[model samples]
Target: MRFSVLSFLTSAAAVSAAVIPSSSSAPEKRGGSISVTPHDSYSSSIGVLGCKINTNRAAYWPSSPDCNNICVKVSANGRSVNLLKVDQSGGAHDISYDAWNYLSTGKNATEAPTAGGGLAATYEDVPMSECAHLLKDGKHLAFAAANSMNFITSCSANTWVGKNYALYNILNTQCTWGYDELCRMPDPSQGNQPICEHTLGLTVALKTCPVYNIAYPTGKLSIAV
Candidate 1:
């Protein structure tokens, strides 16, 4: 049997591209001991999501070149939040340019995203407005990032409702009921649950965003906040 040499080369290149880390700033550990505040006692109203990378194992590169699927620990401020391990089998699984752009560059509501390139911003520093852009994009990338960073699924719903959770605004809205089901904390009520933007702690898990800070030196499987 003859194997196609060109096909092997092409496959190798594709895999190389997927796994390689783009040139960018590596996360530096701040001078502080590792700390984790539990979700039950944690309290905050800022609505920020940060990704603490435990182990970047994903073939796809995140906005931060160093980021990978390796166990991302979601946190708000300095407290730890519980994340549901989701099976992204159904529906779409893609990260949009706009979402990727914001994640890589910390693009805010005011700034428009360019075509390509990565950013140095960690999940913690990424502004809420930039996150809003991702949430509003209504793509699987938004959902992926949300899940990675442990953003409240209901938060995405409220985002879909936009500024007040009043009218169902498609532009402001991101994911649908289907997306929410992907989360570990699905709406207990039958059918789709009502949009509750202002209400906090609607779901069993505490509200949180991504925390991209990783504990690099220890080589431990944890994203420190």
Candidate 2:
């Protein structure tokens, strides 16, 4: 069996709130002014989360507080909607499906028209045994198997959405659908093809572990998972 480059972020650490960077060149204040209940949240300082800002409804968790921190307010069918910032796990580069929906369906957003009706942007589970390595005590075993996550955080909504292996080398196809603007993320969401390879996110997890002093504790990982 072959592995990928992107391992897993095993080690744990004390992280502070970070923001993504926004555009330096302003959009040249246009003509008329607009109001928004659910507005598009834009900011100049964005970290860890990248340059994208959350819309009225795209954000989740502490990142969001009510109808604030939105990206853009879209105008659809005479009604308005707010675009929040939700995230995609592996693609780490693009926005989540839910966030995509919220942003496009708002009066606060750019009103990117719906499906030609007019044109709308559109946007999972697996087994437990298959995901055993990812568990510690019926939960994400970040500490048990991977031994980096410290095994405390909650698991993603569903499992088995996809699977990947870690290796020093990756195929181009692996990253065909993804796009990487930084050294961190290098693949596209749709990746290239059977020949195109990429470093999987799992690889990144393990790689970052050592930096955080989280070496894999032999017998700690499991394939039965």
Q: Write the per-residue lDDT of candidate 2 for residues 54-96, one digit (tens) a residue.
A: 2113322222111112233334334433332322122121222
The list of candidate 2 runs beyond 4 A from truth reads: 1-26, 29-70, 84-96, 99-118, 121-225
Estimated TM-score for each candidate: 0.18, 0.19
RMSD of each: 18.7, 19.5
Compared with the true structure, model 1 gives a TM-score of 0.18
Q: In candidate 1, which residue ranges exceed 4 Å CA deviation?
A: 1-45, 49-213, 223-225
Residue 201 accuracy (lDDT) in model 2: 24
Candidate 1 residue-wise lDDT, 136-197, digit = tens: 23222322222122222223332321222122111101111112222222266743333323
